[model samples]
Target: MSIYVGNLSYQVTDEDLKQAFAEYGKVKSVQLPTDRETGRPRGFAFVEMETEEQETAAIEALDGAEWMGRDLKVNKAKPREERSPRGSWGGGGRSGGGRGDRRY
Candidate 1:
């Protein structure tokens, strides 16, 4: 089972997250989202556990709990929506025509 954790402090690290949830159960992985340009933590993360019991435990123990001066939000992660690949210009369009169809 996987969970989405949000409202994190910028200083929060994967180790901190793991330690917090470790008290409840085994954490399979912890992923903190980072800024695309600055590469700094985006103040949210995702945690995955091997069992529903573990997930439930972590959620019950951590949700709305304060950590690093911020309230942590824990809940089941939603499935990622499929996105189209980049540069997928499948639409029919034309551009940069030199004065065509114009009374130049």
Candidate 2:
């Protein structure tokens, strides 16, 4: 399971996040995304722990806890939603077709 850590200071690093959660259990991984255009931390991160129990413990301990000069927002990460492929816009919204578009 994963935990979403928000309201993070942009300076927070991978090691810093791992260490903060280490008191609860083993941290499997941390994914800190960056802005595509500016290449800066996005102010949040997703952290995976070795087990669901560990994740829960971390969530309970860290949620609303202050760290690095900010109140941390921690919770179970929501499942990622699937998106339509770029430029394809997915199906079924067009109102009608002109006479020239008739298949017959």
Candidate 3:
């Protein structure tokens, strides 16, 4: 299982997250998602530890702790939900049929 860390500073790196959690126990992995359009940090991350005890310890110690100028929100991550594929028009609205008014 992985841990969800929210309210992180944009400047926080994967290494920073790993180091912070390492104090409790072995850190398996750290992932920081980025904005697809701008490629910027999303201010949140996921951390995986070696054992549940380590995870619980990290969560308890860092849940409300201040780090990198922001209060952390740490907890177990929920499973990702499945999403349907987007349409060719980007799935914002109706795909077929135009305005139906054309000048001859």
**Stretches of candidate 2 exceeding 4 Å from the true structure:** 89-104
Q: Evaluate all candidate structures by whole-model CA lDDT and list the values in order.
A: 0.90, 0.93, 0.93
TM-score of 1: 0.81
lDDT of 3: 0.93
For residue 75, model 2's alpha carbon misses the true position, in angstroms, by 0.6
Per-prediction TM-score to the true structure, in the order listed? 0.81, 0.82, 0.82
Once fitted onto the true fold, the runs of candidate 3 whose alpha carbons sit more than 4 angstroms away are 88-104
Segments of candidate 1 deviating more than 4 angstroms:
87-99, 102-104
> Which residue window of length 10 is worst by lDDT in model 1?
95-104
What is candidate 3's lDDT per residue for 14-102, written digit by digit as tens? 99998899999999999999999998899999999999999999999999999999999999999999886776446557556377744
Candidate 2 lDDT over residue span 13-95, tens digit each: 99999999999999999999999999889999999999999999999999999999999999999999998779996557755
| Local accuracy of candidate 1 as per-residue lDDT tens digits, 1-104 | 58999999999899998998888888899999999999899989999987899999889988999889998888999999999999997765655545575654
Q: What's the C-alpha lDDT at position 39 in model 1?
A: 89
Q: Tell me each candidate's RMSD, in Å, in order.
A: 2.9, 3.3, 4.0
Better candidate by lDDT, 1 or 3: 3
Worst 10-residue lDDT window, candidate 2: 89-98
